[model samples]
Target: MTRGPGRWAVLSAFTVLAVVMLLPFVIVALNAVKSPAEYSSGGPLSLPHGLYLDGIVQFWQRVNFGQKLLNSLMISAAVAVLATLLSVLNAYALGIGRVRGRLWILVLFLLANTLPQEALVYPLYYIAKQVGLYDSRLAVVIIFTVIQAAFGTYLLSAVLGDFPKAIMEAAAIDGASRWRILWRVVVPISRPTLTVLMIFFFIWTWNEFFLPLVFLISNDTQTVPVALGVLQGDKMMDATMSSASSLLGIIPAVAFFLIFQRTLTRGVTVGAVK
Candidate 1:
């Protein structure tokens, strides 16, 4: 049947893509468990003589992985929530209402997105310092929310554009306020998009390095990426330790995706269905 070939093609494509994406992780895993000499002498693709946890153990001890993870989680979670809410609100306002200046607003967001993040870093850093929030977790969260909001808003607006207008009219007929409609109707119906947004926001905030690298000076406030950088430098690029830290830094995002992959896929397809 046609279905058989189509299924095989899809599976084959996914397998190829997965292998491509996971190559670095594969290297990290093997190197994570390799002795330092074995790590350097063994090529990235080579097998190790025996499993060793020294690199991982040392990284944990040096970085205080638990505390860093907690900080990352708090910052990431806060950013996700704020970004999602702001995105949803913006999308609903633009999608459901007749705002005269909607096009200009959307254009401004798109223009900002086109500008490289590096271009604005200096100004944003100065502003953060002026606000007395430099080096704080709250500062990171706020920056993450603002920097990510444009793309999130654009994506959510596209999804909302495809949402059925009949539902909005019916809710209005039932005398529902915009807030009630957003909370009771739109959000529940757009659950998939929201999940995808949250996952992406979490990933972005968790892995953010450059902003944190520039702004945060205190070791205690360093996120995983910053911590990993310090570790990598301390080890003078010791392959085992570098690889172990890389693996540790990546696990949370990978696990999060694996846990919610179905929702992520559904979100992409559903949001794209115009």
Candidate 2:
């Protein structure tokens, strides 16, 4: 009887929530092109008079943003690929192999994800120095690969556990080895899920700042987020420049999300229905 009113109510609530979520990005975009004088005179919410790109340009040059961007891309891509592989192997053994203590090991990985990075910094830092990996992008990649793989293993394990026994049986009957089944059968069937995980891993590692900050001390070794933090610490930084830096920092992450949006949607839909 009251369905129409309830429908409108839910729609209205979601509309407001969407705006709240997007307001910051909109404001940043609006100000990214606004001259400082215009920004000061018109305030943040007001429409910009015209495009102003100096701040973004200056910040990019100052930070050698190209190098930092490359560092981030290299590190995030390595972590995504390496972590996904590591997770697949671990999850395959524990989930599909039905190994003893699999449940406990999954639980351990789950718990590991919850442990604060702050708690491990000292040990990680000490180990990096001891291994002569400190302040190197390789060190950051190795560290984040393991950190991200923990979550990946936890997730992929559950997904693979429910994999159809009939299909597995068929593969085994066809004289397929475990290795072939993994590569040819399970992997192809699970490609969408793995793609989704890779996207998440890439974005998660891209936005990571703390460990990158601690480990990547050199300007060339730093990532976008770490570079943004360093720029933000400058006493001479202005609000307009701050907005520019923030916009620059998030553009790659947003681009990646958009590029994989279709795959992400399909993967999620498949996961839900399966």
Candidate 3:
């Protein structure tokens, strides 16, 4: 089969759109290698005359970038794991289990997802203080896990609900317990959905800023986003260093997407079939 002229025209349009979208990132990467003086003199879009590593080095040392990166990775990983696990259980129960009022329960979870973090931050702050979890990485992890799980449950419920009931019935007839069937049968078939959920959880948790700023008050506990926010507020801000830090901050997320790109593409249409 060969594409017609119309298909080729559409492909060309999309190619142009992709380059337009990537322009900002290209500019940022170019500036990341320039010195602050060069950034100011040569303009943001100008290519660096030579590779200058001083900006990156200065940013890393000034902000304790290693510690911040570790903190972000740990918190994001914890949230992703916890959220994915809970979402799986919640989706199984609400989507597949013959439970009463499951639709209402799902509606409640959807509503919770709609509520902005700003609206709940004050109450959460008070609760964290009362529970002695404030200023701890565990606090951030727990908060993000719960928040991300709400959306994950909603997204995964559709996939789980669409699963074939005949297979579950067959497993049940074979004397497999519900727990065993879920772990052995449903889980294996739902790998694509789980992978998608894990990727979303990791990316969202890594990039979250507000909740971390509120819950992780201590410098040592602060994640990358909050640390970057603080860096921007310093009296003497360096444009090139800031650009370098921004680039470094996004590397983990970009790498994660690249690693799971195939899984993500496959998962998109996973539940469309039986």
- What TM-score would each prediction reach against the true structure? 0.89, 0.96, 0.95
**Best-first order by lDDT:** 2, 3, 1
Q: How many backbone overlaps does candidate 3 show?
A: 0
Look at candidate 2 and tell me the lDDT of residue 62: 83
Supply candidate 2's per-residue lDDT for 119.
95
Cα-based RMSD of the predictions, in order?
2.5, 1.7, 1.5
**Per-residue lDDT of 25-85 in model 1, one digit per residue for the tens?**
8888998899988766867778989899988898888779988888888888999999988
Task: Report clash pairs, candidate 1.
Answer: none
Models sorted by TM-score, best on top = 2, 3, 1
For model 2, state the Cα shift of residue 92 in Å: 0.3
Evaluate residue 238 in candidate 2 and report its C-alpha lDDT on the 0 to 100 scale. 78
Residue 35, model 2: Cα distance from true site in angstroms: 1.7
Find the candidate with the highest lDDT and give its number: 2
Q: CA lDDT, every prediction? A: 0.84, 0.93, 0.88
Q: Model 3 segments beyond 4 Å from truth? A: 1-3
Taking the tens digit of each residue's C-alpha lDDT, what string does model 3 give over 18-136? Answer: 99998878887888999878888989988899998888898888878899999999998888899999998999998899479988988999999999999999999999899988899
lDDT for position 77 in model 2? 98
After TM-score superposition, what is the CA distance of residue 88 in candidate 3 from its true location, in Å?
Answer: 1.4
